[model samples]
Target: MIESKRRRRTVANIATYFVLAGLSMFCIGPMIWMLLTSLKYEADIVTQTMQYIPRRVTFDNYVAIWTQSGFPRLIGNSITVTFLTVTICVATGTLAAYAFSRFAFRGRTQLMLGYLVVRMFPAVMMIIPLYVVMRGVGLVDSRFGLALAYTSFLLPLFVWMLKGFFDSAPRELESAARIDGSTRLGAMVRIVMPLARNGLVASSVFIAIAAWNEFLFALMLTTGQGSRTWPVGLQLMVGEFQLPWGVLAAGGILSILPVVVLFAIVQRTMVQGLTAGAIKG
Candidate 1:
């Protein structure tokens, strides 16, 4: 009877794995198809027949698009805007989150909720006002301006996320550090932060992803390639009457590579951070 039960459990586990594997394939299938399409020849892409793989693969698409579309400038612009946004969000969010987690002030909770309301407003709704404001400030078509916009939208999220981790941390650590002559800020920076690295890393990843992929704000704010991002560059690849599917596919794959690599590299830390925070909470 025990052996029979164990065999049944094994079969159940196998079925679960099968289901999970199938789901994963379903989700990843489109991304896989894009990569395959990128490697295909133009003829393969334009063909009526569904071709999963290329008859003749070429590196020419990647090479041609890189310079033709001002991709290097776009990449630089994206990296700059993303990192700047992350920096502003992390620096400002960490302090605010630490304040919210560690201190008490009247209306603090209400203010925190207010920040969420800002995010609740669809970004598209904010575009017209944001455009007018940006125009007034002479920030249109500027990368720094775009970075500031992203930081505003992303900061509240970062603050709330970091606050969770901070809340999960022990207050005694800060108290002990203070008794040992460390300032409150020092305690937070030196002791509490090290313990909260997992959360910080995860939050940073989120900020990077959001900033990198943001399109609407970028589109409204940036008119020239001087400040255009990969998403915009990818969009412009489509012409009035002719769309180059192979080039578009190649661009999509290239665009996602950095975020994918970063996620893969730090996924373990993010998981640990989230799980540890959950347990503590």
Candidate 2:
């Protein structure tokens, strides 16, 4: 019986490893392909035969993109827009979430419900109205305008997610801080927010990634490289007359660097926060 059980356990372990290995390949394969493609010569990329591995690897594409393709300016624009959106969402959402979680007021349920409803609609539906508003305010083709546009889409989700994290903390913690003479805002900043840090980081990561990768609004709102994001610039590279595969792949790799570095830095906190909220809430 013991020998039979050992055999079964070994088989199960092997199957699990096989499944995990396949899943890992499915997820990371494209990223590997993009990186490899970026390093290949344009000739290798355009050939009739598939060149899974490049015969020649070079940084010429990377150099060309940075110096010639307006990638640097687009990178700056994307960073500015994404950072501003994340900041606005995190700042306003955390405060709004605190209010929702801590206080009971008139129309509170309705207000929360309204946030949910607004977020449920397709983002494309809001484009026309948002365009009108941006145009009216002379914010068209501006980084701030794009950031604000992104905020409208991300804010509700941020508030709802952070509110759950806020709700998980005990009221007595704040009450105890109140007894010690901290103001409400002071207590939140000092006591409650510290406990909720992981959730905030995780939410910020999601918001930043969403804003960075958004193509439609970036294309519609910003006409020039001065305000256009990497996504929009990257799309333009695949033009009507010809396709620059090597440069496009290089741009893809470059665009992913910021997000990858960010995820690597805060991923542990993000994972813990995500699972912690699920368990606590």
In terms of lDDT, which candidate is strongest?
2
State the local distance difference test value for candidate 1.
0.88
Q: State residue 26's C-alpha deviation in candidate 1, in Å.
A: 2.8
Residue 280 shift from truth in candidate 2, angstroms: 15
- The whole-model C-alpha lDDT of candidate 2 against the native structure comes to 0.90
Query: Could you give candidate 2's per-residue lDDT for residues 166-198 as a string of tens digits?
Result: 887778878999999999999899888988888
Q: Rate the local accuracy (lDDT) of all candidates.
A: 0.88, 0.90
- What is the per-residue lDDT of model 1 for residues 127-154, given as tens digits with 9 covering 90 to 100? 9999999999999999999999998889
Model 1, residue pairs in steric clash: none
TM-score of each: 0.91, 0.91
Off by over 4 Å in 2: 1-5, 271-281
lDDT of 2 at 190: 89
What's every prediction's RMSD, in angstroms? 3.1, 3.2
Q: Per-residue error at 49 for model 1, in Å?
A: 1.8
How many pairs of residues collide in each model? 0, 0
